[model samples]
Target: MIPDHNNRDAAATPPDALRVVPVEPSLHRALLRLRVRPAQRDRVGSMADLLADVTQCPGSEPMAIMRGDAPIGYYRIDASARSVAGRDFAQPARGLRSLFVDADWQGRGLGARAVALLLEDLAVRHPATRLLVLTVDCDNRAATRIYQRAGFVDGGARYHGGRCGPQQLLLRALP
Candidate 1:
């Protein structure tokens, strides 16, 4: 069950007790400082680029992946699935973009937890959202594994022109 909004703690707490909150001006500076490993950049855009996308692109919102009071990572939700995947997903489908966990937080289940929280938040606030879609560099085995474990399945679409080379589309349908 989704936690009750009346209970702020429960509403803020997600899988593994990680707190996922909407990105606020107060957290932007800290979130911009969160970075993945040097090589992971090709797979995930930097927070600054993500912020710009949220601005230039409509129908997207920046989210902060927080651990306690500290901003630990970032993710963006794009209500217009077309923005990311260039396909006609259901009208309410959201593009899960720019998911990045700081290098120090990698391998600690942080990314998965952030995804869980985002899913719950969407279910609560955007009930019409039918699915979540993303594209990961096909060679990012670690991220692919994490998304697979979090219930995303290959959507059978591949792109050859991504900045990071071949990419595989993954989709997770919301219940």
Candidate 2:
């Protein structure tokens, strides 16, 4: 099992205490199925496709949260020079491209734990990286709260048109 070094309280512990691990392509299909809401099924699938592409792309590495041998969620950490949320963060900086916990695993702190694990890994492996960024749907209050508690600050917002809701950019600066 991967070590839980994030200081996660037991009350906030994820069901089964999922351990975050390096994601493998073989688990991609399974990780794609993990989502908190049925309405987001298509979006989640698209995210999986993006993740697969990133995993194959040079200079990118992905990680997943797992329980025993089952994938519960996944996130990609990009080290390449790219702009997210209209801001050009430097290379070696990390961006949380996608993160989703299984519906059955919601409200147990699994999402928070997964993010904490990713940030911890980034801090060690890429100490010089200055920023960690992510985008959230404006309507996703729960996720916003989690991010806020995790030290992410609101950086900016982007309109995606229609009722899909605006996207809010959040960031956590690394020392």
Error of 2 at 59 (Å): 2.7
Task: State model 1's lDDT.
Answer: 0.80
lDDT (C-alpha, whole model) for all candidates: 0.80, 0.70
* Candidate whose TM-score is highest: 1
Q: What digit string (tens of lDDT, one per residue) describes model 2 on residues 1-175?
A: 3334343443466576666666666777887676657666544455557575784767677677777568877767766435445457654456676677788888788788777777787776678988887777787788889899889999765647424567888889877
- Model 2, stretches more than 4 Å misplaced? 1-16, 46-48, 55-57, 90-92, 159-163
Tens-digit per-residue lDDT, 62-87, candidate 1: 88777666778888888788877898
Q: What is the TM-score of candidate 1?
A: 0.88
Candidate 1: residue 72 lDDT (0-100): 84
Which pairs clash (backbone N, Cα, C closer than 3 Å) in model 2?
none
| Model 2, TM vs. native | 0.76
Per-model TM against the reference: 0.88, 0.76
Q: Where does candidate 2 have its weakest 10-residue lDDT segment?
A: 1-10
